[model samples]
Structures are given as structure tokens and as C-alpha cells.
Target chain A: MGQVVLKGINKFYDSVHAVKDVNLQIRDKEFVVFVGPSGCGKTTTLRMIAGLEAISSGDISIDGSVVNGLAPMDRDIAMVFQNYALYPHMSVYDNMAFGLKMRKFTRPEIDRRVRDAADILGIGELLKRKPRQLSGGQRQRVALGRAIVRHPRVFLFDEPLSNLDAKLRVQMRVELKKLHLRLGTTAIYVTHDQVEAMTLGDRVVVMKDGVVQQVGEPLELYNRPANKFVAGFIGSPTMNFATVTVTEANGSLIAENAGLRIRLPDGTARRLRGHIGHKVTLGVRPEDLTVAGAADPDHPCFDAVIEVVEQLGSEILLDMKVGQDVMVASVEPTVRVNVRDKLRLAMRPSSLHVFDVKTEEAI
Target chain B: MIEGAIWRKWAFFYLPMALFLLFLLFPFYWMVITSVRPDGELYRPWNSVNYNPFWTWNPTWDHVRYLFEETLFAAWLWNTMFIALVSTAISLVCGVFAGYALSRLNFPFAGSLGTGIFITYLVPQTLLFIPLAEIIRNYRLGDTPWSLILTYPTFLIPFCTWLMMGYFKAVPKELEECARIDGASRWQAMLYIVIPVAIPGILSAGIFAFTLSWNEFIYALVFLSSPEQKTVPVGVTSELIRGDVFFWGPLMAGALLGSIPVAIAYSFFVEHYVAGLTGSVKG
Candidate 1:
């Protein structure tokens, strides 16, 4: 129901800058995800926005009003924590009613809102149960239900599904997406899971080491990552990186790495015109490589020894060693591969991502 | 064969535990027998011939009557209960706040302060009684039950505070943050959430405080000049001995009666006592 904007945010714990001068604008009703590894400041940033943590130096605005100096309750934001911090002593009904009671809602209003949230979460039967009596997934719903009953301007989720089992996590993920759709409230979700980021976020902000690497639509970030970190982090099985030397072969460009050399596509090669003979990092997602039957001159080809093979029912993952360099590739489920077998892989030139070796920035 | 092996395994496990239980309960069984023995056989040395004399003869209510009517045993009981209840309440209030602060807050010299609280327990009561008596006299609180209630927390609070600090630490920090976002102030969050969750810990601390005050003798003996103001432990021991002539019958009767409140309290909070006592030691 409200947009959130963070401007020039910087947080420092003593000399260590936990969140650098970051800027983000989240529109009303948008589902934005902050994704990164631990210590990357994603949770810190979310906490700052939630007002659970103070900003060392920055401004956060909710619905165009500055909230940097406000208390969490005064900021009118409800947060669901990773551990689902439901009041252990309170029944689900009271847990959800706590914020309403604090707000001095009428008895009828509190009852109605709590019941409505319980229905939405499909936990109507669990209203009388204490939090310790509920399973992890149900407790997570109660945490969400607690936030929902508040009817705050914005909702903040800090890795809310990280504690559940794999299957429950997936089920809850879908439930959260549906909840967002039904409510249409501006929400900020933080997680390290890229799949959750892709499936849940309207805009995914990839971060690394307290700095914003890139922010864009999920597919846009997936297809055209702004940097090597974003490129490697956004994809499943991860994008492979190879240290290669870019050289002018005849009139076109080719990247030579270890025991493999492949001509770059015309469009991609033209972008590398000035960088010829320089060291670069070749980035390619596992899905972009195919197990080729023969050498295709039109496409880039490399021979690699299969070190490990994993069959995941619908797809096959190959861990291959080409000379001294190792890379992972995802092939079709029908592709037969064995350990120590030499496999010819054809790279899709159009899908090849290149980055400067020194800066690790996308070229 | 496997079922027989499993039975053997369980028997081996229970053998030591069963012996331990019997060893623990034997002393209480002797105390009960001693309290019921007839007057003539009460002082008899433990022998095979005198073992059944108690069964044939009539049990006298003389010791019990002497304790209740001839002495201020009822008054001692009342005084002990009062001091224990008041001190336990005081310790809980002080300990809970101090514990929460130590557990959650960052203050100047917090580590040193925690160490200081723990060190108070290490100071021997015998060593500090003279100085504490002087201070109590200075405050004009000597010879009053208030002096014991006030002094008992000196020992109780430090240990109870340490106990509660550990209990509060076990609660996740995020629980309070959630409550805060729900519009609870820090104190409100503690009152509504933290304290309720720590009921077992508080009960354990309360039992410790009550028992310590109930059984305390050194400070009570030194500070209380009036028989009416004396706690049960000091009063019972002082009245039982008169120039090497010990009144064993009335003494044991009073001792047994005095221990009942503490024993019953221990049984009520036994679970929490075990949990809280070890928990405080670690803290």
C-alpha cells in the first residue's frame, strides 16, 4: 500500500562498512528481493528499512515520508523474521492480535482482522494453538499472519522461509507469492536463495560485500547480469568462469583458455575489438552449453574430461576438467555421460558472457 | 536372543539408578522413624533387640506438644515463612531486572558488573556478618524480621540474578524485536514475553531464595536479639542446647516441622530447581 525508498544509505560497524552508500526505489505494491550471501548487508539493509536497526548515515522514506529516525512501530512496517518469532506463550489468535491490541483497535476490529488473516493463511483451525504446538511451516504462517493483522503500510521479510524443510519451503514460497498478490502491499524480502529471488521478486537486487551489484527484473538480471558476481550468482548450477586471453584470429576475435580456443560471435567480438590480446574472463551458464556430436565450425567447441556426472531426473549436470580448468555444464537428461569420458561441448556464442579479468565487470 | 540382550542392557542401565534412589531415600525413612518412636525407646542405641519396641509401645505426642505449646515454634514458623516469602519476592524483582539488563543491554563495565554479582556469592557469610551487623545497627533495623528479609537478598539476588541471566539469554533476541515492532517498549516486551517464557527459571530462583532464607542461621543468630524476631533455624538451634544438656526430642520435632515448608517447596519446584541451579552455575 506504500512505496519505500532508501537514499544514500551507509552503515558502518566501527571501521567496517556493512552497507555502503546504497540507493534503491521500490514502487507501491512491488515485491522486491535483496539477495546475497551472508555478511553482504542484505539483512542489515532490510532491518534498516524496517527501522529495527538504525541507519548509520542514510534516509529511508515510506510513502514519501522520511522514516530514518522513527521507531519500527512508528514507521508502520510489519516484519516477519527468519526464525518466525511468534510469541511462544501466546496462542496463534493472540499472536496475530498483539499488534492490533497495541494499536488500540476495537475488540470487533481486532477479531475480524485476526480471523481474516487466519483464513488467508489457512490456519483458522490453529488459532487456539500455542506457537510451540505448531510445526515450522505453520509457525511461519502464524508469523506472517501476525504481520498481516497489523495492516501496516509495508511488509518486510528477512529470510522467512529459510528454516523450513525443502518441500515446505517450496510450498510456502508459492503461498507467499499468492499472499502478495491478494494483498498487493509493498513488500521487501531478503534471502540468499536466488531461486526464491527469481520466483518471488518483481525486481531483484543482487548485492555483494555490502555493495549493490545490480538491480533489475529477474529475467533481465539472469540474461544480462551487470557483473561477474551477478552473472555467477543468478543462475542455478552457476555460470562457469575461465581465465582466457582474447586474441585477434584472422579478422575476427577468439578467446584462448588452457587447451580450448573458440571464436567469439560477430556482435560479441565487435565489443571486444579494443580489448584484443588482453586477459578476460569467459562467462557461460551451464544451460548455454550443449553436448555436441561433432565439431560445429559455426559454433564454439571445446573438449573436456567429465570428472563427475549427476542425474537429477529431468536434467544432467556434468563436472568437467578441460586441461587445468574445471567447469560445470547442464546437459539434456537423454545425454549419456560417464566419469573420465572425454566430451565435446558446443557453446552457444550468443549466450556467452564476457568480463574483464582485472575488474571482473561485464564487457 | 536380541530381545533378551535388550532386556539385559536396560537392567544394567537401571541398576545404578535404582541404588542411587534407595540411598537418597534411606535418610528420610530414618527421620520418619525417629519422629514416631515412643519416649522410652527414643534414645536407645540402634540394636536388633530394641528395633520392635516402637511397634509394641504407644507413641507419645509429648515432643510435638512441647514444641507447639511450651515454645514459640508456631511463631518461628510464621517468622520463617514471612522472611522467606518477602526475601524471595525481593530477590525475584531485583534479579529479574538485573538479569535482563545483563543479558540484553550493553553498558559501561557490564562484564565487570556481572563478575561482581557472581563474586558476592563467594564472600563467606561468617566473614561479612560483623560488618553487615554493624550496618544493620546503623540503619536501626537490628532485632527486626525486616533485617533478615533485607539481608537474605544479599545472598539470594546475586545467585538468582545469575540464574535469570542465563534463562533470559536462551530466549532469542529476535523475539523482543518482533514484540517491539508490535509496539511494545522494552519493559513491556519483558513483562509480556520474556518473563512469561522464563516461568520455570523464575520458579527455580524463587525456591532457592525461599530455602536459603528459611535455613539461614549465622546472620539471624548474630543480628536478632529478640526470640520473637528470630528465624526458625537460629531459634531452634539456640533453644535446643542449654549448657551441654541438649533437648533432642523437642529439638528434632521443631527441626522436622521447620524443614517441611522447604521440603514441600523443593518438591513443588524440583524440576525447575535442577534446571535453574545448574543453569545459574553456567551463567
Candidate 2:
């Protein structure tokens, strides 16, 4: 019953077009996350769905009913803001009961729901404490409790975990996933944190500059990003990009730059045949590049001078210079590496991504 | 607070703080002493036998009795309280709504309208009262409590509205939005979420409005002539002084008694008042 669909949604604030022609279909009990950098219109789209921001054009339908001009109260959705937005004057019990009271529920029913939500959030002991008296994580739980007491059709979260400390954010993230699983409510979450987006969403929507770059499941996006921006934004330590001219040699494509030359993978070369003799952007994730062993001649290997080695315990990240371009390679922690050392790095053939320079789209 | 040597702390903080406290409290001390001093001692020459100007050995309550029993001081106190309360209530209702609208709502000419209201406040009462006097006379409310009650909001509304607008702006708009999405209409959201969160601001504004109207002098002097209809500032000054003869003891007594309510109000809500001025809304 919680199917939400947005059709050609657009938003404009005076002369600036904030969101442009976004179309999305969210299934019942689906967790969809919209993720992008700041000013990418992700939060704006979430607000539009919550009915807090009016859409300039197109329609939004919740459970097959068009809700263009409907008030937020009529839309039957709840939003948890990044700052928690807890009513400071109210105790936790009252804060959770406010939504039920506003809807004219019986006092006993409201109390039952409030207590139920508090128990679910493990905050029953804090029922009488005001929001200011609680810690940030507790206040966040109260915000969630407030949203859950109403049993709204869809839940909108606008970076709800951004305010918590790192450990608390990870903990709350797991709790949020568990909560969504238990409630099975269709939820639309917005955040600029890619890790949160990947871990929590059933389908992640990547956006940039008010445009939807790609929408797919987490692994699909990681394996095959639709564009250069998605490829660069979805992974941590960011994907390394280098501009290289493509040339045909013996019916195979070779990507060459001023400092290094590498053969394109067979699958990538087939699609990039038309891009021969044209300069294209080559993208490779940090994890895909490792120290080249003597037996790794079949893979595309390049010489790079290590500039900095960051030991992150699990792996060592080597910041290296390949000609004029700088790239990062995540090597095994056991491998000995030092700054100013010359290392040969080989990238997995199937992991190479080539994008058209003009369109910034994968070729 | 100054952190370093004792001499630096004394020079930079303690000395200045002591001077400020003395300067601020000196007037209240003078008022209290003059109100309780006997007439014989108050008017004594500086060269009199064992003359002491600062300390009065013979303190009396006769001036307080004279003020309460002989003059219309009680009536004036009642009149001022009624007018200040009524006017503050009216202006608070109007100010809260107006401030919320101006700060939160998107409307045509909202910016210019706010500026216009502020400009109205900027017009000093010394000059604006001339036209206000005409309006009062035309409405036939002259020399009545209604006259002051109605006219006080002329300035009080703008003051309250301005203070309230800044307060409402400091409140995060997401609270109301979340309330709206949680099954409350806009008005409900404002009433349940916004207004409650803004209690500190409202209290500070209420205290300021009450003080302004209570101590108001020019409008009370020009509009209220009868001793029974006057407020404290006007009634005390007008009734206690005779032609070429000032009744200093009873005058000081009336002033001292008249200021007690405002003092009590400030002390009662001083914490909230300071918080409102600082304007911090923590989540």
C-alpha cells in the first residue's frame, strides 16, 4: 500500500531550476535513497515528496492517488530531519504522541502507540525526559519514534544520521535498516554520504547538478556506473581518472598518454572502437589497481612513483604519480612500500572503465 | 575570566565591574533613602548641627501613608496595571502572529512591509503623539484607561513584532515542516511546535512591552489629565508637586512604590530574558 511514484517532477526557485524532470517508481516496502554532493537537489526532491516543497511541474502519486495539491497532513507521510527537529518543550512521550493527538486518536490509543514505539527504540526509560536532556543519539531515536507512532505510509529521512558521531552513525544506520525491515514502509532517504547510501538503500539514485546520473542497486552501480560522475562518486578513495588518447593497433584499442601506455580490456575495447584516435577519460577504482607481479604481464600495467603511503591497517593506500596524473592504489598491508619508490601497478582488465570526454558518459 | 595575573584581572575586570554595579544601583539607593527619610531631616541645611546627608537616623513611613491615603496613588497604580496588562496582551497576540508571518511565510511585499512597520516605530513619540492626540480626541477616548490601552500598542506592536520576528527566524523551520508532515496543519504546527518553542522569546517580549507601557510618560501626560486616570509616571509627578513647592518625600515614595512591579517582573524572568537576547535554539 505504500507505493510511491514521481512522474517528471521538476522544481524551480525563481530563476534557478533546482530539480529537473525526475521520474522515479518506488515499490511498496522499498528503501530508496537519493545521494549526491551538496546543492545536487537531493534534499529538495525529498522535501517535494514530503509535500513540504511544492513541485513546479509534474505529479506525485502515493498508493495510486495523485497528491499534487494535497497538504502534508493529507499526504500521510512523516519526515525525520537531520537535526532531529524534536520539540524541545515536550517530553519524549508527549513528542511521540503529538502526531497521534493531532490526528484525533483516542488518548489510550495514543499512549499505547507511544509506549510501543518507545519500547521498539529502547527509549522507554527516557519517556519523561525532555529532548534537550537527551544525547544526540537518543534525540534521533525520539525523532524516529515520533515518526513511527503514526504508522505513516512513507517515511522521509533527510540525512538523519549526519549529526551523530561516527560510531553512533554506524549504529543508528543498522538500527534504521532493522526498523525499516520490521515496518516494511516505503522510505525515501536523502544523503550526501555515499557509504550510507550504498549500505541502506535497496536502490540508490545518484544525482549531480540537478540531474539524475544513474539509478540502480548498490552492486550494479558499483560494477557498471552509468557515467563518469557516478563512477567517481559511488566508491570511497574515489576512482582515479586519466585522460588518454585511444589508438587502434592490430585490431585492438590501446590507450596511451604522455607517461604510460596500456591495452584496453577486450570487452571495453569492443564498445570503444568508435572512440579510436579520440581522447577519452579512463577510470579505475583504487582497489582494482594493485602491485604488479612478474606474472601480471597480461594485465594493463603502468609505472608510477609513490608519493605518499597511507597505512589504514587493513590495506595500504599508495598515492602515486603516473606522468602528470595522480592515482591512488590500495595495496595489501603486507606489501612493503615507501614514498619516492617506483612501483609497477597492474589494473584488472575487466575493471577498466572508459568514458566519452565530451558527454562524460561511459563508452 | 581574564586568566592571567591577579593585577591584570583586577585592572581589566574587577575594577570596571565594581564601577558599573555602583553606577547602576546608586539611583535605587537614593530613591529608597529619600522615600523613608523624615521631612525634618530631608530639608535640613548642609551646615545644620551634626548634619548628615547620606544617612538618616530618623526614618519614617509618613510619606508612604500620605501617598497612599491622601493622593490618587492607589488608583493610578491600578490604572497603570490594567492598561499595561491589557495592552501587552493585545500586542502580544498581534505581534506573535505578525512576526511569524513576516519571518516564515512567503508573501508579496513581506520585506517592505516589515521595514515599513520598523519605520513606524522609529517615529519618536514626541512628534507622533501630536497626530495620535487628534485620533484619541476624535474617538472620544481621552483621559480614560482605554485611551492609553489602545494607544500604547501603536508603539508596542512594532517593538514586539520586531523582537518576535528575530526570535521566530532563529527557530529552525524544519521543526514546523516535520510537524506538518506528521499530520498537523500549518496552524496546528505553529501553535503546537513553533509557539511553544518560542516561549523564551515571547516572555522576553512580554516583559519588555510591560516595562515600556508601565514607564511610558509623554503619552500618559498628554492624554490622561485627571489624577485618577493617570499612570504612575504621570500621576506621581503631577499630584505631588504644588506651585513652586515640590513634595520631595512623598514624590520619592510614590516613585519607589511604582517601580516595584517592573523590578519584580525583570527579576522573575531574567534567565529567559538573557536566553532570548542570546538567541540560541539547540536541537
Clashes of each: 0, 0
Candidate 2 structure quality by residue, lDDT tens digits, A234-283 = 99899999999999998888999988799888888898888888999999
Write model 2 residue lDDT over B153-225, tens digit each, in one string. Answer: 9999999999999999999999899889878889999999999889999999999999999999999999998
- Cα lDDT of model 1 by residue, A1-363, tens digit: 598999999999889999998999999999999999999999999999977787999799998889998887788889999998888778899999998888899999999999999999999999999887889999999999999898888999999999999999999999999999999999999999999999999999999999999999999999999899999999899999998888986898988977888888887898899888798888999998998865466888889999999999899999999877889999999988789999889988889998988788899
Which lDDT value does model 2 have at A29?
97
lDDT against the true structure, each candidate? 0.88, 0.93
Question: Model 1: per-residue lDDT, tens digit, B101-198?
Answer: 99888778887898899999889999988899989999999999888888988899998899888888888888888988998877788888888877
The residue ranges of model 2 lying beyond 4 angstroms of the native Cα positions read A294-296
Kept native contacts, as fractions per model, are: 0.63, 0.86
Best by lDDT: 2
